[model samples]
Target: MYAFEYKRPASLAEAAQLLSGDDEAKLVAGGQTFIPTLKQRLAQPSTVIDLGAIGELAGIREEAGGVTIGAMTRHGQVASNDVVRRVIPSLAGMAEVIGDPQVRNLGTLGGSIANNDPAADYPGALLALQATIRTNKREIAADDFLTGMFDTALEADEIIKEVHFKKPDVGHYEKFRNPASRYAIVGAYVTRYGGTVRVAITGAGACAHRWSAAESALGGNFAADAVAGLTVDAGDLNSDIHASADYRAHLVKVMTQRAVKACA
Candidate 1:
């Protein structure tokens, strides 16, 4: 990696200040994804601000209606937290299947959502459960947070503080993971809350997006058939050597069915 100034901020306010002042700066959380990119010369930030030293950005708190997870909470921590497991089992299940033991242990929730990789798993859960992203500057709804592949609404200076997810009565996340990296080839998160049903799909599109047609069909009747009947347009889906757009669309349907069945 190229030489860069490293700042270990003790508070979110300090981190934001450092980030705002450095035009060619980047946030380093778990370094699970960014480190590799830096080594490969794909990203060349002149300054790296590490958020690991910030004590306020790591924990799981159970609230009355849901749970709030600090952005720096590790994937392993989320997968194992009793409070998270009880409140959002599907989220825990999704965390359990992301990457391998090493990656899970090292990856942070903020890092995952901020990276917004096209094939990442967390975005689906965040969208389906109607999670809110709290940053140093402002709170953003999940839909508004994710803008595109490897993108987010976060400004260069903004830092994610935590994420709030509404507790669903029942929900499940299912994914057909890429064999090598364990990234989702196609993943679906299904959630049901007081007659409302939400279904979010990732890994197939340029960014994680809700399957509105399927959500509407299944909102009234929560069933595999309700989602299976609707067709997902493959016009903008990711297509590569591992899986074609058509195949990814098929997996989306299959995985959504599986997720709904699991929710049942």
Candidate 2:
């Protein structure tokens, strides 16, 4: 890694001030992706502001008719937290399967969503559950927060505070992941709240997005057969060596079906 000044602020306000004052500073939460990028010389910042020491940014709480997860909360914590499991077990399950033990231990929810990796798991769940992303500045809807690959709507110095997720009446997540990294090649999160059904798909496109067609169909009939004829367009999906765009589109449908089945 290139030489850089490291600062671990004890509070959110301090971190925000530090970030706003430096034009060439970067934030590090769990360092799962940032550390590797630094090692490969893909990113060389003048200062690396570590968010780990900020105690207020990590925890799980029951509130607002659902659950609120602090930004710096680790994946393993989310996976094993009793409140998360009780309020949104499918979310906990999704957290449980992200990467391997090392990645799970080191990756933070804020960092993952901020990085906005297309294959990341949280986006799908957030979109499907219609979660809210609360930052130091303001609150952003999950749909508005995730823009594209490796992108978000956060400002230059904005810091995510917590994510508030509505407890769905029924929810499930299904994914076809890369065996090595365990990153989803195509993943689907299905959720139903009263009569409204939402389906979110990840890894197949530039970013996680709601499958409106599938959602509409499933809303009418919450079952696997509901989406039997639904087709995901392949033209805009990611086609890497791991899988073709067409294959990923196919997996979207399959995973959505499987998720719906599990919810049933």
Candidate 3:
């Protein structure tokens, strides 16, 4: 890694101040992705502000008919948290399958959502469950927070403080994971809240996105047949050596069907 100044701020206000002053500063949460990029010389920030020291950015609590998780809360914590398991079992199940134990132990919800990796699992859950991202500066809805693949609405000086997810009446996630990295080849998160049904698809497109057509069909009939009847357009999907765009679309439908079963 290139030589850099490291700042570990105790508070979010101090962290923002430290970041705003440094023209080339990057925030490091879990450092699962950024650290590798640093070693590869893909990034050369003048300063690295570690959010780990901020005590307010770590924990899980219930509020306002939903669950709020501090940004620094690790994937392992989310997977194991009793409140998460009780309130959003499907979301907890999704967290349990991310990477291996080491990555889970280090990786965090805020980091995953901020990075917005196209293949990441948390994006699928966030989008499907109607999550809200809280930053030091402002709060962004999940739809607005994740702008694109490896992109988000976060400003350079902004630090994500926590994430709020509404407890769905029923929800489930299914993924076709890459054997080596455990990244999603095609992941689907399906949710139903009262009469509303939502389907979020990831790993098949440039970013995780909601499927309105499937949601519409499922809103009326929440069944595998509802997903089966709808045709997925391959035009907007990602295609690569591992799987073609058309194949990914097929996987999306199949996984959505599986997710429905899991939700039921």
Candidate 4:
């Protein structure tokens, strides 16, 4: 909203250089989140570096036992990609349900993961699938990459190149979203490989987190009924006009059940 210089660099190196040199500069991926923040005067960057012109940041590749998605890859592309559907259908399903058509077409994986929104779908999926976050500088495990609400381990000016998700033997994501915005009130992703099980819960706390209790319970039984007795604490959850923390906590259990069932 405020007057700011804009630069659409042809390569990642130029974009990084532009960002690193300016103390008050920001990177623009899809601008789904950043644009609104700027309009509200919540952020005022001296310069805006757009990564849209960089062609290398936009594709999907199938790996030996996983799928590697580029940073600028849109949700719509991921949702409809044959390789994604064949290798990790749950991730494809997650992308298909994100914020309707416009948002799907504009929102990028790197933007979503870098913003680290607690209610974002990709964070929970990354955690459950044990994905790797690849940056220009280094590759960070999903567990270590996300630190807190809207926070990541990425250094200043660091650009995420891609994200790699390992194929789970069985996986599914279930979300209870706010009707108006479609943001997850409480979302759960369940993944299983051999005897190991992993569960990630989002929108119920400060950040998307792995639900170890549910993982252990379902790892032993691999059934919806196995998690019926589990209770999520509301003590550290989000509470607002749409839903109370108590309600969100309740939904976490319900959605987790649904996700597990989908996997089964």
* TM-score to true structure, per model: 0.98, 0.99, 0.98, 0.98
Query: What lDDT tens digits, residue by residue, belong to model 3 across residues 1-264?
Result: 899999999999999999899889999999888899999999999999999999999999988878999999999999999999999998889999999999999999988988989999998888999999999988899988778879988987788999999999999999999999899999999999998998999899998999999999999999999877789999999999889999999999999999998888
Q: What pairs collide in candidate 3?
A: none
Off by over 4 Å in 4: none
Q: Model-by-model lDDT, in order?
A: 0.92, 0.94, 0.92, 0.92
Using lDDT as the measure, the top candidate is 2
Worst 10 residues of 2 by lDDT: 121-130
* Residue lDDT tens for model 1, 123-192: 8888998999999889999999999989999987889999999999999999998899889999999999
Question: Residue-wise lDDT of candidate 4 within 1-264, one digit each (tens)?
Answer: 898999999998888899889989999999888899999999989999999999989999998699999999999999999999999999999999889999899999999999989899899989998899988889999999989999999999799999999999989999998899888989999999999999999888888999899999998999999999988888889999988989998898999999998987
| Model 1: lDDT to the true structure | 0.92
lDDT tens readout by residue for model 2, 42-160? 99999999999999899999998799999999999999999999999999999999999889999999999999999999988889888999999999999899988899999999999
TM-score computed on alpha carbons, candidate 4? 0.98
**Off by more than 4 A, model 1:** none
Question: Candidate 1 — which pairs collide?
Answer: none
* Model 3 alpha-carbon miss at residue 158, Å: 1.1
Report how far off residue 235 is in candidate 2 (Å). 0.4
